[model samples]
Target: MSEELGMREEPRGRLYRVTHRTVYEYDDDVTSSYGRGFLCPRDFPGQRRIDHELVVDPEPEDSSTGVDAFGNHDLYFHVTQTHRRLVVDAQSTVAVAAEQTSWANWDDWADWEDVRLRLAQEPLVRQYVIDLDPPEITDEVLRWAAPTFAARRPLVEVVAELTHRIYKELRYDPGSTTVATKVSEVLAQRSGVCQDFARLAIACLRGHGLAARYVSGYLLTNPPPGQPKLVGADATHAWAAVCFGEDRWLAFDPTNNQLVSDEYITCAWGRDYADVPPLRGVIYSEAKTSTIGVSVDVAEL
Candidate 1:
């Protein structure tokens, strides 16, 4: 299970309101809809979850809320109403914490070998060692990450270099890949979205026998100097976090070539995206075609 990283809002002095909504429209009516979502934000020691609410339209007949295996807010709902459109809306307020030191300064960080040996002795992290059903780690991934995970280099340093390399090598091309894209395909294509980069980083870390998880969240973005802020233009972001030791992990964004900072709002984390999707479900409908639209907005509060 993941522990809350108590960093708190006092240090960063930043608070934000996030709105995420997903809508589905079908050609025919959907008789039964079942959904399980991880749309609520998680609280950390340094980060505070001010408030969060999830709403399902056509009110679910059977709905429940609970904590997941990874300690994230899990929501399950079943909508028995017959409809052609379905909506899931989530709103949250959060206080983010900032890291005082730069990731480039890794003097006190643990070495790769020592961290690996220590983690190997811990039997509780069985899930991290095992790959997903299809498996993402490959020989190419290990070989690509080999230069960074040299014998005794500081673990943080290795992670930073790996992130930088990915950011430099990969191109961010929207609509180039989908959630089904594999790590191998990403490497060969050299282009992907944030989730792709995050998964690739996770694959690299796992290829070295290190534990890493996928982080889903939002990132504060500013428009160009003269451009006005666009409402409902924000998108969810993804990053990767590597375990340093017990109850401590280091998160880095290969898409941005930097460590996760106060600008990020973590919602949930898991072994992969399948573990924590914003909205996913099954609909028993005779509709042959359906379309989904997502709108997210992150505003300073």
Candidate 2:
């Protein structure tokens, strides 16, 4: 169940197209079930635009799901259960383009200051800013041993090193925390999933006079030996993206202990999960439980 799924797209001239599908099935004979799904968010730079459609079988059914247009992302959710069966399908065609063509320098904070001000005005994003506690950059944490990383020991370097150290100090336990869990709780427990890790990183980065946000998306895995291509499997993932300088936001995945490469498929970016839950909504069902299944396949066109 903990396997890393593979998903890769082959280029066709200057463009690459990717399609993603997800299905959820429930067998628990409960009276109801609830679920949520996310849509194409603005942070997915390579994607041009996205369209979504919902299909529910039978004429009159007691089920409800819709998209939340708050923040810079869109999310949808629903709750209900029928004795017969229930199925939800979401499909999207993502258009890929060349990478960002700009380089940012350290002294460009003036340019990013505007962006920071704008993001801080949003109600959802403002909450993250208010919630973050200033990180205690102690000499002990700063002096942690890492001879290989000694040369890059400026403030930015310290932030990166501390964040990486925090990731290493924490355990990757998916069930240890939920979306509603607080960063303080995760820090205290020293364990959590990708979401928790991402949130912790963002908070820490922002604490150090840097702009960082939560990135919800999929991680493209390396194909096993003899496998020709990569494909995504049963779950969506999350990470963090820190604004290095100016408009430049570089991604870092502490869960996997790696830098963002061509394999990271971005879906959305915001201060935290509340701004971009892959899927969320209101449901009319009196009682409910839910399950999710996702798969991604990438191949040469």
Candidate 3:
């Protein structure tokens, strides 16, 4: 699918009513299915999830909620009843903080190299800061990110420039790539959706020995003047966050070429897309074909 969600929002802050609906249609009936969703917004420094609920059609035989290792809300459910389609609807009321004034103080931070070495000794930050999978460090990624890692450059400044470079170079074509597309491929193709850009950024940062993680969320969108924002027109969005030693992880939206602010609503994050897909499931079916449809609506509340 389509990755879109969020309402018209202001930089100061706003509470939103978010609804995300996903439907899966299979050619043959699916006797059973086990699914997971990372649909709950996280409570962080300036963001708070007030209330949330998830509904599964045909009612699941069993369901429970828990927090993932990365601290995201993870929901698990299984359906035993035979069905040709499955629907998951998630709704939330979230209060997002205004853009932080602290961003302006980034210039006073330690150099990129210092932050890298600091995180290197911190065992807990290893997994996210290091490239362990498809977004492996390649010469190509290193070359692309080299310019941003100049000596003594403030860590935040380096990432901000890198984020700018990616946004300027990559084309956001929905069908150009899939969830399986690797950062190396994205580098060669120079195009992809939010997820692709996010992963690419993660690789680039890790290539330079910085800690970065993929973030999944919703972005408030604006329609052209005189046009109504269509329901489901907005899809889930993705971005990247880089650690600056200590407990700080600054978020960047290479997809939109901006630092994350109140306009962004974070849901979950992990090493990459595979770690936290909005919705994924295993189904037992003879169907040779399956199609997914997603709809999202985010209205100011």
Number of the top lDDT candidate: 1
lDDT of 2 by residue, 232-282 (tens): 222567887765433455576777665554445566766678777766543
RMSD values for the candidates in order, in angstroms, are 4.0, 7.8, 4.9
Per-residue CA lDDT of model 1 for 139-233, tens digit only, reads 88778888888888888888889999999999988898999999989998998989999999988888877889999988775644785542213
Candidate 1, residue 76: the lDDT equals 92
The 10 consecutive residues of candidate 2 with the worst lDDT sum are 1-10
TM-score of 1: 0.90
In candidate 1, what residue range of length 10 has the lowest lDDT sum? 1-10
Better of 1 and 2 by TM-score: 1
Estimated TM-score for each candidate: 0.90, 0.62, 0.90
CA-lDDT, candidates in order: 0.82, 0.52, 0.82
Sort by lDDT, top down from the best:
1, 3, 2
Better model by lDDT: candidate 1 vs candidate 2: 1
List, in order, the clash count of every candidate structure: 7, 12, 7
